[model samples]
Target: MLALAAFFSGAALRICDGLLPRLAADFGITAGTAGQVVLTFAIAYGVSQLVFGPLGDRYGKALVVCCALFGCAGAALACAFAGGFDMLLRLRVLWGIAAGGVIPLAIAWIGDAVPYEERQATLARLLLGTLSGMSAGQLGGGLFADSPLGWRGAFGALCAGYVVIAVMLLARLRSMPSAPPAQGGRLAFFPQLAAVAAIPWARLVVGAALLEGVFLIGALAFLPSYLHQRFGIPLSAAGALVALYAVGGLLYAMAAKPIVRRLGERRMVLHGGWIVGAGFAAWAVAPAAWWAGPIALVVGFGTYMFHNTLQTHATQMAPAMRGSGMALFAFCLFLGQAIGVWMAGASFDRFGALPLLLLPAVALPLTGWGFSAALRRRAGAAAA
Candidate 1:
């Protein structure tokens, strides 16, 4: 059930990717301008973490997740009914806030329950649900928008999905035992946030996660649009191709356990970064639309390779206050995403998509190397 909620959250985030062209046409705006909706979602998703993190720590994580699921349902329904782009944008903010609580809190709960050695593998399994929803969202948006039901129908479907998952989660909550809140204080997450912010390791993890969002997610949001613009594919076909990224993610998730054991986090993340860079660079130059499909797959696999390592560290950023720690980690990540989308949109308008793809291709590998070096330093410090 929790995984289902995570799936919807992932779906909600990307539902706009394939809808950008339709949205721009509907609202008499440029395709790049329609990205304001995506920006709003990312911003709301990031900021809400500040509130939900504390609530999750004070209340039980499962309880907060359940409540957030209902909130997502309500917001998604509102989005379907929204008459104007402005109204729809506001509803997306609400939906993003609600969606924000599900995944990070789930991660924190896992951190509380599982040993670190096993946590990455477990998270990879959970990632399958999220990635599946992403593919569904990407495809559904284009298909629905092209149908009589349109983009609004997509949100309507999302509302129903959210309600179903919320009900299941409620039942699961009743059947299962929940861990106690890590915190129960009036001051809330501030002190915990401070403690995390004060730690060098925590700062490094957060910084790196933020970069992941900026470089990876920012460019990724534009892939469907790139296909539409460059290859002249139908939106549905573009979405279907873009959805191949999730296939890559699923492939990586299936092999994650063995990969983790063989390469270790440091080496795995380093290669993941380079592989993602190579994928993006290849996508940028591919002469035919068919070639971009496999490139998207490589991007997905590499993304999880790099991101899963960061997520594992995020869960331990503040061992005793993991909800707060993970929340802050998510905040930085999506905040970077918001910034990245805005920048990418502006860049697309001015410079086209080549720089967006190619720049990240270079930066991501360096990011991976930076984190790998940090890990080595920390290991040496521990030995010392």
Candidate 2:
């Protein structure tokens, strides 16, 4: 139930990305302006995790998760009835704030309940829903918008799903154990925040995760519009292509444990970064629509491969302060995404979509080099 709730919350946000074109057309706005909906959501999503993470530590994961889901559902319902573009944008910001807690809190709950050795496989299962939800958001949103039901109806359907998940979560809340009271005052929170900030390896991992967010959210949010503008494909087809990106991620989630076992997490992160960089480059140069599918797959797989490893390391970084650590990790990640969307939107407005792909192509390799250098330094320090 917890995992499903997290999945739906994520899916709801993702659906908005694919629905951008139709929504923009309906509201008589530019694609760049419509992109603000993505920006608003990303910013709220990132910031809210900082608040909810501590709340989970102080109160309980179950309570935090339920409240976030209910809030998300309410926001989605409100969005369904939004009177104008501004109204929908506000609702999206609220929705992002509420939905933000679901991922980090869900991961923290798993950390509290599961052992380290057992976590790889379990985390993979949880991520399956997360990635699948992203895919559904694209495909399902496209379908909803194209059909007689329309974009508003699609949001309504999401609201209904949220309600069901909320009910189940509320019922199950009593069976979950509450976290013990955290030590110190509100000021103490700063120390944990500082602890995460102080760790060199943690900073590197967070940087990589932030880059991952930039690539993932920025690319997915605009890919449909880019395709329509460049290739003149309809919205549904473009959305379906975007949906295919998740197939690669889904495969990586299923295979990640064995791959990590064989290759080691650190090496996997390094290699995955390279693969993603290559994917971005491929997308930049591809001459036809057929090429987009394969490049997107590479991008998707590589992005998630590193992402999974970064998340595992983050959860282990400070076991005692798992909530704060994970929350900070999420904060950096979403902050990167918000910046990516804004920059990409501006770049698209000025230079066009093709140039935007170069940002990740350049960024991923640099991030990968940084990760490798950090790993070597950690090894040398241990040897000394």
Candidate 3:
């Protein structure tokens, strides 16, 4: 049920990816300008995490999540009925702020309840919701935006999903036991945020996650646009094809246990990085839009291969302040994503998408190698 709410929120975040071209045409802007919607949302989401994380810790994680989900419902509805591009952007920023709290806090809640040894697999299961949302957002925006329903219809549907999830979550919360708020002075939140930031291991994890968001998500935001221009494909077709990325993610969720058993964390990061790099490089050269689908699949698979590992580590980084810890983790990741998208949009405006895609192709592998090397150093130091 909680995962359902997350699915809607996640969908809302990514839906703009498919709608960018439509938005541009409707508002008489370039595709690059339409991309600002994504950039704005990511920035709002990232900045709001700082507030939501501590609030979740101080109030209750579940309670805060429910409230945020309700906020998302309202914000998404506002987006559906927005009067202009500026109105749409404003609503999306609010939607981003509302949706920001759902996933990280849910992870923190799981961290509070689950044992360390079993947490990775549990996180993988939860990722099913996120991955599914990604698919729905991408595909739904593509499929419905061109139908009689139109782009506004895509958002209206998302609003309905958020409302349903909010109801279920509210009912569940009413039946469950609640924890007392974490006791603190008026200034308590900043200290918890500071404490998590102080840990060397947490810093590394957050940094790596940020890079992941920057390189992977930043490049991906423009893929549908890239396809439409390069192949003259319609927005719906382009988006549906790109939605294959989530198919790859679902594959990872399904096989996470065996993959982890066979590969280990370091190898998972190393191999996953190489695989994603290869996939994007293929995307750069693919002769047809159809080829991009398979490439997106491989990229998605490799993404979770690396990111899920970071997620597991984040949950344990500051157990005493898990909400703040994970929230900081999310803040860095989305902030990186926001910056990445902004830079990529500018690059798309200037040089086109090929160079942008190819850059990440090289960066992801090196990032994996860096993480592996860091892990080895951490292990050696602990042994010493």
Candidate 4:
């Protein structure tokens, strides 16, 4: 049920990638300018972490998730009929705010529910729902943008998905025994967040999450467009190929259990980061359009390899305050993504795609190694 609810959030996050060119054309803006559609949403989603994290602690995580799903539905509905680009951006802000609430809290809920030893595998299974939705949304955005139904239709579909999921989750919520909210009151979430932030390990996980956002999520946003301009692929086709990113994610999801057992978190992050970095490096220099799909697949797998480890850490970072911990981690994450997208858009406009693609390829490996090193240090400290 939680996984099903995550589908719309992932869908809404990536739909703009496929819709960017069409939005640019329709709104008489540069493709870079059209990227504000993504930027606004990301910013709102990031900023929302401040609000939702503490609120979830004060309220029930499941109930917070249910309400936020409805908020996403409302914002998406508004987005469908936005009269101007400005209006669309506004609606996206609302959409972002709502989306901010869902996944982090859901993970926190999972943290509350699952044992640490088994949590990573459970999270991997949940990721399948998100990756599947991302695949459908990315492709649906391109297909809808190309058809008479258009980008608005894509949003309409998102709204419908959110509504249905929200109802289903709400129903599930009712059947379950209610969890008592964490102790707090109005305006107390900030101090709660501060207390969690004081932990050295928590800071390390949050920082890595921020870098991952910028390097991966932010940079990858431009890939569909990169394929379109460089290879002259149709937007729909470009979207289809890039949507394979989720396929890569799906592949990792299926393999996560065995891989976790074999490599554990340290080696997983160590190798996963470089693998993703290498995939992007390949993307920068791929000789032909045919390579896009397979490369995206590889990149997606590495992304999860790196990212799921971070997620597992986030859930446990502040075990007593899991809601605050996850929220802060996600906040910096999308915040980094927003910064990444903005920089990538500028980079694309000024320097072009090579730098945008290659930079992360190089930087991500460092990110992985740094985090893995920290893990080793902690292990050594534990052993001592």
Candidate 5:
């Protein structure tokens, strides 16, 4: 049930990626300008992480998640009714702020509930909800936009899903027995966040998360647009094709246990990085639109293979302050995402998508190897 609820927020986050072309056309703006919608939402999402994390830690992660789900439903509904680009953008920011609370906190909630050795497998299973949402968001956004109901229908459906999930989650929250307080109640917000930052391992995890957002997610936001322009494909086709990325993610989720058992976290990240980098590099040079489908699959697979490891580490970063720890992790992530998308937008405007995709191809493997090395060093220090 929690997984089902998390799906809506995940969908809301990526839905706009596939809709950018249609939005640009509707608003009579350039593609780069339309991309600002993504930027604004991500910025708000990043900023709101501070509020939700602390609130979750103080009040209870489940309660906070339930409330945020309600807020996301409202914001998404408002987005459906927005009369102008400015109104839509504002609503999207609200939606980002609301939707931002769901996933990381849920992970924190899981961290609180599950033991560390088992947590990665549990998280991988939970990602089914998230990865499914990613696919639905991209495919559904494009399909709805081109359909008679148009882009508004896509958000309307999302709003309805949010409401349903919010109700279900709320009921569960109310029914479940309350958890004991952490830190004798919540510490003051800034101090809590500062303490999280002061931990070296926490710093490494969060830093890697931030760069992951910048290098990988930032580049992904432009895939549909790139397809539309480069190969003259329709937005819906491109969007549906990009949905293949989720196939890769789902595969990882299913295979996670064996992969982890065989490769260990460090090698999983290192190898996943090379795979993702190869996928993106291939994407940069793909001769036809059809090729992106399979390439996106590989990209998706490699992404989770790498990212899920980071997520697992984050869960254990500050066990006592799990919510705040996870929130800081997400804060760095979406903050990096906001900045990355902005920079990538400028790059897209200047150099086009080739460079945008190509650069990540080289950087992601390095990112993976670096994070792996850090993990090994941290492990060695602890053993010593």
Candidate 6:
């Protein structure tokens, strides 16, 4: 039920990605400016996680998550009826803030319920729900928009899903675990925050996850329009192609444990980074429409492979403070996403889509290499 709630919350935001061009056309805006609609959501999403993380730690995961869902549902309904681009943007920001708690809280809930050695596979399954929900959102939103009901109808459908999930969550709230209060009152929050900050490995994990968010959200948000403009594909067709990105993520989730075991986290992350970089470059330079599909698959697979490992690593990093650590990690990850969307929007506004692709291709690999190096240094210090 928790995972399902989280999935719906995430899917609601992703559905917006597919509707951007249509929404822009409706409101008399450019694709770049429409992209800002996504940026507003990303900014709110990232910033809200910081507060929600601590709130979850202090109050309880289920309660916080349920409330977030209700808020997200209300915000989605507002977005459905929004009169202008600004109104929709404002609603999206509110929706982002409300939905932000779902992911971290879900993960923390898993941590409370599951054991460490078994967590990798469980986390992968949870991520599968997340990735699949994203794909479904894009595909479903595209189809709904193409129907007589239009984009608003599509959003209204997602809003309905949110309400159903929230009701289910509220029913389950009594069975959920709550973190114990700290000795230092309000000051206890500082220690968990400080603990995550002080750990080099934790920092590396968060950094890699942030880069993953940059490539994942930024690419997904912009790619549909890019394909539409470049290949003259209809929105539905473009969204279907975008769904291939999640197919890649599904493949990674299926294969992550063995890959992580064989190659280790550092090597896998570095390799995944290179693969993602290659995928982005392919998308940027592809000479034909047929090529874009495979490139997206590669990029999606690599992005999730790296992200899954980072998330698993984060869960293990500070087990005693899992909620706090995970929250901090999620904070950085979403902050990167917010920045990615903002930058991608600006890049699209200025230089057009072609240039926007280059940023992730270069940034992802460099960040991956940096993370790998940091891990190696930590291993050496441990040996000493």
lDDT of 6 by residue, 56-163 (tens): 777877788899989988988998898888888888899889988888888887887788777777888888878888878877766765677767897788789889
Q: lDDT of all predictions, in order shown? A: 0.89, 0.81, 0.88, 0.90, 0.88, 0.79
Expressed as tens digits, the lDDT of each residue in 230-334 for candidate 3 is: 999888899889998998999999999998888889898998899999998999999988998988898899999999989999999998889999999999999
Q: Could you give candidate 1's per-residue lDDT for residues 1-384 as a string of tens digits?
A: 667888998889889999988899888998789888899999999999988887888888888999999999999999989999999988889989998899999888888888999999999988888899898888887787677788889999999999999998988886655566665476756877788889889999999989998998988888888889999988888898888898899898899999999999999889999999999899899999888788888889998999999999999888878888888999999999998999899888889999889989999999999999999999899999
In candidate 2, where is summed lDDT lowest over 10 consecutive residues? 177-186
Query: Model 2: per-residue lDDT, tens digit, 1-384?
Result: 776986796687678676778887888877878888888988999998888877788778778889988998999899899999988889889999999878888988888888988787778788888888888888887777677777888889889988998999899998987657467677777777778778777787787788877865676688878887888877777778878788788899888878878977668778888888888788777788767877777777887777777788788877777888888899988898898898888888788987688778877877776776776787789999
lDDT winner: 4
Query: On TM-score, who's better, 2 or 5?
Result: 5
Question: Residue-wise lDDT of candidate 4 within 1-384, one digit each (tens)?
Answer: 888888778888899898888998899988888889899999999989888988887778889999999999999999999999999998999999999999999888888888999999999988998898899878887898788878899999999999999999888886654345778677688888998899999999999999999988988888888999899888899999999999999999999999999998999999999989999989988999979899999889988998999999999988778889999999999999999999989988788899889889899999999999999999999999
Superposed by TM-score, candidate 1 places the C-alpha of residue 291 at a distance from the truth, in angstroms, of 1.2
- The model with the greater TM-score, 1 or 2, is 1
Q: Is candidate 1 or candidate 6 better by lDDT?
A: 1
Off by over 4 Å in 6: 177-192
Cα-lDDT of candidate 2? 0.81
| Reference-based lDDT, residue 297, model 5 | 94
TM-score per candidate = 0.98, 0.94, 0.97, 0.98, 0.97, 0.93
Candidate 2 residue 344 Cα shift, in angstroms, is 0.9
Displacement of residue 27 (Cα, Å) in model 6 is 0.6
